[model samples]
Target chain A: MNKSDNNFLGRWLANDLSEKEKKEFENTPEYLAYKDILKGVDKFERPVFDIEANLQKQKEYNQTYLKNVSKGSKVIKLRPWLYAAAAVFLVLIGLRTVFFNTTTINTNFAETKTWTLPDNSIVTLNAKSTIEYNDRSFTNDRSITLDGEAFFDVAKGSQFTVKTKNGAIKVLGTEFNVYSRNTTIEVQCYEGKVSVNNGKNQAILTPGKGVTSIDKSALNSVEIKESEPGWMQQKSTFNQVSLGRLIAELERQYDITIEKGDVDTDRLFSGFFTHTDLNTALKTCFEPMNINYIFKSSKTIELKNR
Target chain B: MPEQQVSVCDESIYDQLYREHAEKICYYLYYKYGDMEKAQDIVQDSFAKLWMNCSKIIFGAAKSFLYKIANNASINEAIHQKTVLKYKSTPQKTYTNESPEFQMEEKEFMDKLNQAISGLKEGQREVFLLNRIEKKTYKEIAEMLGISVKAVEKRMHLALVTLRKKIGKI
Candidate 1:
C-alpha cells in the first residue's frame, strides 16, 4: 500500500480499529497523521442527542398497540391535561395566521382559532397575542401588521406580505415565523425569499437567514444559522448571539424575564438547543460561567452573580 | 374489549417518520440554510408534507423519504428567499493581519483544499459531504442519492485522495 493508504489505515487502527485493519496499519506513517487529525477533530464533538421525546412521539404514532387502541375511538382518549396542552399547542400553531390577516388580532387566555386568509394562507392564533394587517385587501398586495408572535406557511401565490409594527416582511411562498414585539422584530425564514423593510432599510432574507429589527428601522443586524424554527421544532439554532439579545429571545419564547446585571453582556454564544427544558436552557447559559438567576415571578427573571 | 387491529394510515406513519427524523433533518437544514429557526420551521413543514403522503411511502424507506423531503424543503426555501447580494464578512473572522508567512501558508492550504474539493466531479463532493459531515452510512447514502454503494465508496475514495493530494502530505 502507498504511504497515504498506510497512514489512513494507521489512523483507523488507533480509533477502535476493527480486527481486520489493525494488522495492516501497524507500521504506517500516514496512520500517525490520520491519528493526529482524528484526535484534533474528536475534541470538537458535535452536540447531539437521541431526542427521546420525538422518539416517544414516534413510538406512540407507530406502535401497534396505540394504533389499535385509538382506531375505533372517535376521540382518542388522552389525559385531561393533554387536552389543555393540545389546545394550547393548537393555538400556538394557529397564531401564525392571525398575525397575517387582521389589522389587530387578539386572543384571550381561553381562545385558540385558525384564520384562513384571502390567499388561503393558514395561521394559528395564540392566546393573549395580537396581529393586524395594514391593508384591507390582500389580493392585489399582500401585507399585514403584527404585534405579537406568529408562525406562517404563506400559500404560494403572486406575492405575500406581512407587516409588523417595527417592520414589514414581503415574501413569495415561504414558511417562516415572525415575532415583533417590545421594539424588536425578529424574522426567521424557513422557505422562500422574505424582504424585511423597516422604513428606509431593507433586508432580503433567504431560508436560514434571520434579521433583527430595532426601532422600526431596517434590519439592524442579520444572522445566518442552521435552519430551525423556534416554537415547533425540537432544536433551536443560535449564531453569534449577544447575551442581551439571547435573553430577549428567551423571554419571548418562554415568557420569562432574564435580568442582565449579573451576567457578562459582552459574551456571544453559538450553539443549538434540542427540545431543551426551560431550566436547561437557563442553566446552559448560566451554569458554565457560574452566573446565577433569580426568578421574580413566572413572567420575570433576574440574572445575578452567584 | 376485543383487540381491534388498527391499520396505520400514511398520515400516522408520516407523522411518526417526521418525529423520528426531524432533529437530524433540522440539524442538516440549519447547517445548509444557516438559520436555526428557519430550519426548524421548514423541517416541520417538510414532515407535515410527508405525513400528507404517508401511504405512498414504505415504512422501511421512511428515513430516506424524510431526507428527501428535507432536501427538497431546503432547496425550495433557498430559492424563495432571494436577496440582492451584498458582501458581509462572516463573523467567524480569519486573521487578516497575521505574519505573512503564516497567512500565506494558511491561504495556500485552504486554496489547495478548496481546489481539491471543487476539482472533484459534483457527485464526489456530494457524496463526501454526505458521508463525512452528515455521517451517513454508505448504504443509506447510496439509497438516498440513488447510486450503488460501491459507487459511493469510489467517490469517497476519490474525494479523500484529492484532498490528501492537495494537502501535500498524503
Candidate 2:
C-alpha cells in the first residue's frame, strides 16, 4: 500500500502516525492498495522445516568445529590457537579412503589402530577387534559391524550403528565404547545418547549409563563415572568380570599366551591393568586373588596359586 | 561464582536455544540471501559451530553468536536471487461478498504486488517482509542487523516506495 509521503507511510507502517495523519492517510486512494500489499505479503508461506529431523542431524557438531571466535567478550574462555592443533588433528584423520566398497579393518594381537570412517567419524579398535562398514553407503547408512571391542567417536550426521553378534548400539552422534564378544555384550555411553538392542533385550542409555548382557539372557544397567573408556587412557579396567575373559583381554593386550596353572579361570576378577608395563598389569590383575604368575618363557606366563 | 552458570553443553539449555533461535536465523538468512535451502544449511552449519564452541560461549551471548555465524556463512557461499515468495492466503469472507469482476481485479492486483515485492532490492524487501509478515519491530530488526533503528526505517520506507512505483495504477 502506497502514499506519496513515503516518510508518512514508514511512520504509519511503524504504527506511529498521529490521529490526523491516520485519518488523512486512510482517506487517500493509495491507502487501500498499500494495506492490500501488506496484507498480501503477510500470507507468504515460509519454507516448512522438519525441526526435529534437523536437530537430530545437527545437534552433535561439537568436537571438530574449527573457528575460534576472536572476540574475547563473546567467550567466557577463549581457547589457545587451535590452528596448529587442527593441523595435528588433520593428520589424525585416516588417509585410507574407500568408497563404493566394504572395508573390514582388524587389529592383530596386542594391536589397535584408529580408522576414520567415510564421514570422518573415528573408530579406534581395541586389540583383536574388527570393524566393517560399507564405505559406499556409509554416508547414508552409517552401520558398522563390530566383532570385538572398540571406542567410537561418531561424527554428526546420519544414525550410526554398531552391530555385533550379540547386540547393536545405535546413536545419532556421540562417543561410546562397545565390548561385544561371544555371548557377552557391554556398551558404555561416554557422550550423548545411545540405544542398545540385543535380540531379546533393549535399553536406552544416556551418558555414563550402560547396559551389560551376559550369556544373552537379559540386560543389566551399569553405572559408570568416567567420561570415556579407561582403555582409551592406556588402561583396561574390569568390574567383576570373569577371570577367563579378563585373561583373554590380557592375552590380546600383551600378545602373550597364559597357562592357567591351578588358577580357576572362571573366578571373577575386579581390577585393571596398564598396557605400558606387563609386570604391573599382571600384579594388578592377579595380586588381589593371592595368585602368582611365573614367566614360563619370553612370551608366556603361567598363573598358579601363591 | 555462587550460582551455576548456564552451560550450552547442557542438552536442555541447548534445546531451548535451538527452539528460540533456529527459525529466526533461518528466516533471516532466507530473507537476506533469498535461498531457503541455503539458509537452512547455513543455519545448521552455524549451529554446529555453536556446539563446537559451546564451552567458551556464555549463555548470554549465544544468540548473537548464532546469528553472526549464520550470517557469515550465508554471505560467503550463496548468491542472492529474486525472492519469489509463496503466500498461503486464508480465504477472506469479504472475498465471498465481492463481485466476480472485483475478485479477479483483487487477485490481479495481488499478482502485481507480488512482482513488485520480488523486484525490490533484497535488503529493503527483507526489512519490509520481516516487519509486515514476521511482525518484527524496527528496534528488533536494528538489533539483528547491528544497525540503527533509523536505518531499518529507511529500508522500510524505500521498500514501500519502490513497490508503489513498480505497480503505479493502484
Candidate 3:
C-alpha cells in the first residue's frame, strides 16, 4: 500500500476509520502499520478509590449539620472576634435547619416594603407580594422563600440560596431581582455567580445578566441596562427591547395591558423613562416609535400603528 | 430470574457507587481534562448533584445519570477555566507529557496519543470520548445528545479518520 493507504489503515485500527473505508484498509501493509502504532499507545489502569482514613475525615468535614441553639439569659463576656465567630457559627447552624421560624412581610397593592435580611441583605418587596424568613436569628447560608416579586441586595456569604416555587437560586453574594409567579420565574443578577436549577434544567447568571424561565425551561436571557434595576424606584431604561416586551413591563408596573396590532411585534424601541405619571411614561415609550396608544379603560389600553 | 434492584435515593447506595466507580470516573475525567484536581472535583460535584436529586432519579438509570452529570460538570469546569484564563490575559498553554525521564518512551507515546485526541474538533472529540472512553453504544450517544443515529455514526467515522491521520498510520 502507498502512504495514503498506510494512513487510512492507521486510522482504521484506532477506531477512527469509517465502516465504508474499513474494507480499503484490510490489506497486510496497512494492517502492519496500524499494529505498530497501536503498540505505542499508553495503557493505564482506570483510577480506583484509595480507602485512606484521610478521605473519610474530609468527607465528614464537608457533610451538612443541622443544629439549633436557643438564646440563654446569662451575660457571658467574650472577645470581639470570638463574638463574630460565634455569630458566623450560629448562621451556619441556622442554615442546617430545614424549617425556618418565619415572619411574613407583606405589601399592600400599589405599595412597596424594604427590609434587611438576617445576613444584613436588603430586599424590596413589590406591591401585592409577601416574603417569609426567620427573624429571631440569621444563618451563614442565608435563604428566603418567595411567592411574588422582590429585588434582593444579597449580603456576601460563602453560599446563599433563595427558594421559589419553580426552583432554587444559589449565589455567592450579589445584588439581584427575582420574580416568580404562576408559570413564569425570572432572575436578574447584578454581581457574582447565581445558579438557578429547577431539578432538571439549570442556568447561571453573572453580573448584569438576567434570565427568564417558563415551566422550568429557560426562555431567554440577556444583558440589561445597569439602570434597569432602578425601575422598581420608577427609573426605567430600555435597550433595543421589543415593543411587545416593553408593553408587558408597562402592564406589570401600572396593572394595565396595552393591546397592539400584530404588525408592531417586530418594532424595536430604545429610551429611558423615569418614575413619572403613567401617561407620560406611556407617551415617552410610544411616540418615538411612531405608535399612538389610547386608554380603553383603567385596566386596558389599545395601541395603533402610526 | 429477578434483576438486582438499586435505589438511587439511598445515601449508602450512592456511597457504594462512589466507592465502586470513583476511580473509573476519575480516569475518564483525567483523560478528558488533563488536570487531576479538576477531574476529582468534577467527579465529586457529579455525586453531590446525584445525592441532591436522588429521589427523582430511577435506580436502573443511575449509571447513565452519573455519566451525564460528570460530562456536564467537566464541560462547565473547562468553560470556567477558559474564561478565567481569558480574563487574566494569559496565553493558552499547550499540553505536554509531564512524566519523568525514566519513563521517557512511554510518556512520549502517551503524549502523542493525547495530542492527537485533543486536536480533534470539540464535537468530534466528544463523540469519540463517549464512544471509546465511556463505552457507550452509538444509539445511546445519539439519544443523550438528541441527535439522529446516522449523525452519530457519521461523526464517529470522521473522528476515526482524523485520529488515524494524526497518528501517521493511514
lDDT of each: 0.61, 0.82, 0.66
Q: Point to the candidate with the largest DockQ.
A: 2
The ten-residue window of minimal lDDT in model 1 chain A covers A38-47
Residue A242 local lDDT, model 1: 67
TM-score of chain A of each: 0.52, 0.66, 0.53
Candidate structures ordered by DockQ, highest first: 2, 3, 1
DockQ of every candidate structure: 0.03, 0.25, 0.04
Model 2 residue B98 lDDT score: 70
lDDT of 1 by residue, A175-214 (tens): 7777776777788887888888878788888887778766
Which CAPRI tier for candidate 1?
A: incorrect
Local error of candidate 1 at residue B88 (angstroms): 99
Per lDDT, the best of the predicted structures is 2
lDDT of 3 by residue, B1-170 (tens): 22245666665776677676666666556655556567777776676666666778876677778788988787776874521100011222375455567456555555566577667665665566666656677777677666776666767666666766787741
Standalone chain B TM-score for every prediction: 0.50, 0.87, 0.56
Q: Considering every candidate listed, which one attains the maximal TM-score?
A: 2
Residue pairs with colliding backbones in model 2 are A1-A33, A1-A34
Better of 1 and 3 by DockQ: 3
